[model samples]
Target: MASKVIHALYNDDDILMLAVKKVKAAKHHIEEVYCPFPVHGLDKAMGLAPTRIAITAFIYGCIGLAVATVMMNFIMIQDWPQDIGGKPSFSYLENMPAFVPIMFELTVFFAAHLMVITFYMRSKLWPFKQAENPDVRTTDDLFLMEIEIHDNEEELLALLADTGAVEINISEK
Candidate 1:
């Protein structure tokens, strides 16, 4: 099934932001926006919910910490206890200082790596996946806003034109 959509092209980020706000105020649903660079506050203007990746990173870091602790304890304390530098390795608490660096490294490693994987999965961006952007110019110096039409094509066209869109195109998706 092909659905109709309006692609409004903007030459500047400021114009795009204003257009987004106006369209949102007029109660028109914007399907997506593509920009050559990141536009600050655009997410809020689009009424998107805040991302939860931070919480997931924290959880992954904790898991990494726990794994490192357990692995070190089992290796140094129970598996083959060795007295290096005259410090007995029979207890984990006494040998805790030596494991600080490993714990910190593992925590950061897990947090960063897992966060990227989580973000990719959540965004449905798999390996070799095709891009969904409608305009190639959006990857260069243009900003493209996509709005789905719902029986008000003329009204949307007029509104988009008034919002300072340089070029407006209608197509089926």
Candidate 2:
């Protein structure tokens, strides 16, 4: 189904930020805001919940640590126990220091790779996905703010115009 939306174009990030605040203050639901580059604090401006990716990363790190521990113990102590650098590998505890770097590296590797995949899944982004952006200029130097159209279209048009928007467009999506 197609829904109506308002697209307000802004030439500057500062103007776009102010417009976002005003729109939110007026109790209008903004569909999204697109910018050529990342703008600090924009998420807060949009009143979005804080991301929980850090917690997932911690969990992934723990999993990686466990896998490394099991693999290292099996390979070093159980499979082929040997003496290296005058140190006997009779137990995982005794040779723990030698595996510290491997443990840390594997933890970071798993966390980073898994985190990327997690983020992509959460955002529904993948290879060959069509662009969802409404304006091509938003990928360049322009910032585009999209708002759902309500019954008070005239009021929204005036408000958007006063917010220093370069262009105002009404469309169905």
Candidate 3:
């Protein structure tokens, strides 16, 4: 069976934020909000759970740091050691300063790359994926809020209109 959804369009992000807070306070379930650009504090206004991507980035950085450490130790200390600028070549501890740049680069590289991949996976976004935003204008200049309909369509529409929505639509999907 198809489920009914109400799409309310807001011309401005500030208005959208206010509408989200109002809808949430009225106990309506908001499926999502789509906008041309990110709306600051909209997630909190919509009462969304906080994301943990930062923690994952930290873990990825640690992994990268470890890999760089081990790889540098083996290549410089065991595989092939060479003297440069009279620096000690026999001990990794002695040559630690020389490896600092590589370690920092690799740590940032892994964290950024892995974090992007993880975000893509979590969001189910990939190349050639079908667009899911209901309104094309949402990608241009509009903000859309999707609400599930229970039984009070009229009341919902009226409330959405009162919240400064420029356009409101309903569909079953």
Candidate 4:
């Protein structure tokens, strides 16, 4: 099955932003926007919900800290109580200072790595997945806005033209 969509191309990010706002004001549903670089406040302008990646990062960091604490306690206090440098103490609390670096490193490592994997999976960017970029020029400098046509092609084209779209094309997807 093929669906018809309108592709409006813009040369500047500012123009694209304005176009998006105008289209939204006219109650036309925007499918997606492709840009060469991140546009500040684009997500808010598109009315997208806030991401929860930070929450996941916090959880992963806590798990890493707990694992580090348990591993260090088992190794230093229970498994092999070493009396190094004349410090004859098998207490985990007394040897906590030595484990601070390891704990910090593990926390950061888990947060960073898990966040990356979560991002990739959430974005549907598997290793074998094909790219869904609508226009190649969007990767260079142009910005492309895709809007599905719902029996309002002429009205949408006129609206897009008024919004300063440099070039517009209608295609099936």
Candidate 5:
């Protein structure tokens, strides 16, 4: 069976909320929602769970910090230790302040670079990947709600009209 989407375009959050409430009252299935910018309490309005991207970013940053610390300590203290300007080379505990800059740089480098790679991989985004965006305007200036209807097109249209949708379009995929 072909899937149908009844998408409504809204320019304001109030209208969006009213539409959402109407859809809920009528027991319609909403497939997706798109917005130009995040609206306050929007995930709650849509009943969505919080994303774990921040958690993933924190874990990746910690991994980077740990790697940098270990690598710097091993290179400077353990293998081929060199005495610079008569500074002590036996242990870094005394002059650990000198390694702060390098450590900070490595931490930022790993966090930024590795986090981006991980996010892209986890989101399945890669070079030349074409995303299936329903409407280009939805990405910039409009908020869209895609409602799925099995066979009740007339009933769905009535509901959308009652909710004050500015424009409506149907697409089959």
Candidate 6:
């Protein structure tokens, strides 16, 4: 059986919340939600788990720090010893202050750049990729609720109507 998406449109946040509450109370499966702007507590209302992007970013930042430390230590101490400006570079522990700038830069660079890449990759977004937005209006002034249905379109439509949906349409995919 092919999956169907019923799109419900809401103009205001209150109406949207009410609709979401009612749909959730009815135990109907909501496939996705589209909003013009982020709605506070919507993720909790939908029972969605928190994103792990922060943890991923932290790990990537640590990796960057490790890379920067090893590279600097090898270059300054082991590989090519440079005694620039009369600052001894026998070991990073000897003059930890000197490596602070490079460490900070690498940490920021790795965390920001790699976290963004991870987020995009996990979301299946890439360069030159067209986003799959069903309704253009949903990006502006509309909130959409996509409900997946196995059968009983009439029942779903009635539920949506009872929830005060401004507009509703069935998606064929």
Global local distance difference test of model 2 = 0.95
Ranking by TM-score: 1, 2, 3, 4, 6, 5
Instruction: Sum up the clashes in candidate 2.
Output: 0
Better of 3 and 6 by lDDT: 3
In candidate 5, where is summed lDDT lowest over 10 consecutive residues? Answer: 39-48
- Candidate 1, residues 81-100, lDDT tens digits: the string is 99899999869999999999
lDDT of 2 by residue, 1-173 (tens): 78899999999999999999999999999999999999999999999999999999999999999999999999999999988889998889999999999999999999999999999999999999999989999999999999998698999999999999999999998
Clashing pairs in 6: none
Write down the TM-score of every candidate.
Answer: 0.98, 0.97, 0.96, 0.95, 0.85, 0.93
Point out where model 1 deviates above 4 Å.
none
Regions more than 4 Å wrong, model 4: none
**Please, what are the lDDT tens digits per residue for candidate 6 over residues 65-170?**
9999999888888999888899887777986788899999999999999998998899999889997888999999999988887787999999999888889999
Give stretches of model 3 more than 4 Å off: none
For all candidates in order, the CA lDDT equals 0.95, 0.95, 0.94, 0.93, 0.82, 0.88
Pairs with steric clashes in candidate 4:
none
The sequence of per-residue lDDT tens digits that candidate 3 reaches over residues 100-130 is 9999999999999999999999999999999
Error of 4 at 81 (Å): 1.8
True-vs-predicted CA distance for residue 172, candidate 1, Å: 0.5
What TM-score, to 2 decimals, does candidate 6 have? 0.93
lDDT of 5 at 31: 83
